[model samples]
Target chain A: MIEVKNLIKEFEGRVVLDDISANFQKGAVNMIIGKSGSGKSVFLKCLVGLIRPTSGEIRYGGRNFLAMKNREMKRLRRDMGMLFQGSALFDSKTVLENVMFPLDVFSRKNQRERRKRAEFCLERVNLLDAADLFPSEISGGMMKRVAIARAIALNPKYLFCDEPNSGLDPKTSQMIDELIQDITRDFNMTSLVVSHDMNSVMNIGDYILFLNEGIKEWEGSKEHIMDSDNDKLNDFVFASDLFKKIKEADAIITGNEANEENRKKLIQRMEEEAKDL
Target chain B: MTITGSLENIGEYALLMKRVLTPPDRMREFFREFFKEMYKLGVNSIWIVVIISFFIGAVIVMQIALNVASPLLPRFTVGAVSREIILLEFSSTIMCLILSGKVGSNVATEIGTMRITEQVDALEIMGINSANYLILPKITAFVAFMPVLVIFSMFLGLYGGYVICYLTGTPPVSTYVYGIQAFFRESFVWYSIIKSMIFGFIIASVAAYYGYSVRGGALDVGRASTDSVVINSILILMTDLVFTQLAMG
Candidate 1:
């Protein structure tokens, strides 16, 4: 688990991440959701030491991350893996080489073992056939999968993904979300993802932290997100017609208007509507 | 740019070098990258250097023979002049100016794209020093390999003059060969090589600094590439002047 206390980040004179505190539990997909310019990315960067926080306590497995020396921080970073929004695969490297990069630098394994490990990772991502291809030769969805494979090659304890489905199609986004969720569960890794994808939020977000203009406006699980009473959260979440209709159906079912059969029918209808959209 | 801003840039560049010149995280990976850089930046550039040196060498010989044709000056003066110019300036300083535009821009654009695309950030997150991993090999390979390029430029340049004089036969091939051998200071060859080594560092490192400093998008990367070439050209010229004054004073 990771604990953040009063995390604040300032750029020049402006505060980008206000005093915010949250807990990210292990073995779960923790999502940070916010509008554009709402500090979601900033918060994630601060958590990973990409951006320095003005004041904060970031405790990763009970150790103070901010106070560690350079060597100690580098050692700790070995347990962390990050997926950038653009995938961040080395442009010159093949897909297998990309997967094997972190291992090549840090692994104690021999060359054959490293190759086998990379092949295994590519196979896990169902990308073994494309292992010899370069990143430019792959599709966007395939690139994201390759990035995910590279991220997990080290068997990292923490996985941080930033806008993993930003440019992917809906079907591919769902697949990517499921892949992240499955990896988190299989490895019991602490997964922190910064995303505004509502489908991903509802489908795979085990816990959610919502930010508004650099402040923590709301925080909860998907079960409570649609029913949230916070006006700003509701305005953001129910902005789309599909989500609004789903919320209406939810309210209708929860209210004194229907029996179990009708509620089940309404949920089935909602799922059908979601698929059609 | 303001004085403070210029100073800040210099300060940032100095700090970045401190980071870039450190020991590599893995020697095996470092050597692998080192050879790759040598092939990319050094070996790949040889053909262009040869072509340019040959043409420029021929031109220098023809121009010197035409303009300085006189009864007082020796007939071999054209060959000697061509040799001095190629050895002291063209092969070393001017050639680097051309490379600063080509190789310098290439490094800047490549690394700038990497920076904007977050590849460098990815390296940093993995506990690797991104500056060292990306820039050190380019700098080391270019520096180590520049002397070879300069040596080639020297030979091809003299050979071009040899070929041109034989074809034209104005001063006759014998006099031109004798002129090349006359007052030929081996020190000048070493000076050119050493000066080129310094320029090689300037080219690779300054371009990398610009590329790594890029922050915005593709346009910013282009601007950084242009900035690197311009800055590299200026610095190479200035360093050439300084080195020549110190060596020949």
Candidate 2:
């Protein structure tokens, strides 16, 4: 589990992450969700040590990440894996080499062992045929898969993904989301994902932390998100007409009884909204 | 920027150098990377250096022969002048200027693209010191290979002079050879080699500094590459002056 206490990050006197505190449980897809410029990325960066928090304590498995010495921090980082927004694959390296990179640096395994492990990782991602292909030769979704394969090569205990669904089509995005969720469960790792995609929020957000203007707006599971009465959360989540229609449909199905004629009218309105969308 | 900003950048550059100088976590990987860099920065650069030095040497000899219309001067003066210019300035300083465009911009563009694309961050996240992994091999490769290139430049430059002189028949081949052999101070060879090595360090490190510090997007990467070339050229020339003063004075 990861615990953050009074995390604050400032840039040029502008507050990006304000005194926010939250707990992310282990073996779950813990998501940080918010609109653009809402400090979701900043908060994630702080958690992963990409950006230093102005003042806070970040405890990873009960050890203070901020107070660790450089050597100690590096040792801890060995068990951490991150998938970047752009996939961040080494352009010059083939897929097999990319996945084997961490092992090459940190593993005591022999060359054949490293190659076997990398091949196993590629197979796990269903990318064994693409082992010899360079990153530029692959599609965006494939690149994300390759990145995931590389991230898990070291069998990290903590997995962080920054906007993993960005720039992907909806279907591919769903696949990536499922892959991340499955990996989290299978590896039993503490996974933190930063995203603004509501599909991801609804699909894989086992636990979600909502931020708005650098402050925590709400925190709960996807099951409880719709029941959240917070206006800001509602505005952000229901900004799309399709979700609004879904909310209305849910109300029609579960709320107090209505006449058939009124229910038909409401259903017709929702169908129109869905058509417009 | 302000004076304070400039100082801050210098401090940051120094810190990066310190980090790059740290020992690698894996010697096997370090050697593998080092040899790869040597092939890229050194072996790949030989053809260009050879071609440029030959032409520059030919041009220097031609210009010297054309200007020396005095019958009172010996024909060997042309060879001496060509040898001196090639050894003292052209091979070391001018070749470095050329390489500042080739290798320096390349280093900047490659690293800047990696920076913008977050590959460097990926390395850092993997618990590898990005500076040591990326820049150290480059520095070692350039420093080791540059002196060899300068020596090659010196030899080809003299050969170029010989080819021009032999073809022109104004300064006879023997006279040209005599001039090369005349007043051959061993110190000049050392000076040129030292200068080229220093130039190698400047080109690699300055370009790396700009590349590693890049922020923003593709436009910022282009700007960093251009800035790296400009800054490397200026520093190379400035360092040449200091070295010349210290060695020649």
Residues A38-136, candidate 1: write the lDDT tens digits: 999999999889999999899999999999999999998989999999999999999999999999999999999999999998998899999999999
Off by over 4 Å in 2: A257-277
Alpha-carbon RMSD to native, per candidate: 3.5, 2.1
In the range A86-106, model 2's lDDT, one tens digit per residue, is: 999999899999999999999
Task: Compute each candidate's TM-score over C-alphas.
Answer: 0.96, 0.96
**Candidate 1 local lDDT, B1-249, one digit each (tens):** 799988998999999999999999999999999999999999999998999999899989999999999999999898888899999999999999988988999999999999999999999999999999999999999999999999999999989988999999967999999998899999999999999999999999999999999999999999999999998999998998888889997
Q: Candidate 1, clashing residue pairs?
A: none
| Model 1 segments more than 4 A misplaced | A257-277
Per-residue lDDT tens digits of candidate 2, residues B53-150? 99889889889989985889988999998999999999999999999999998899899999999999999999899999999999999999998899
Clashing pairs in 2: none
Interface RMSD (Cα, Å) for model 1? 0.5
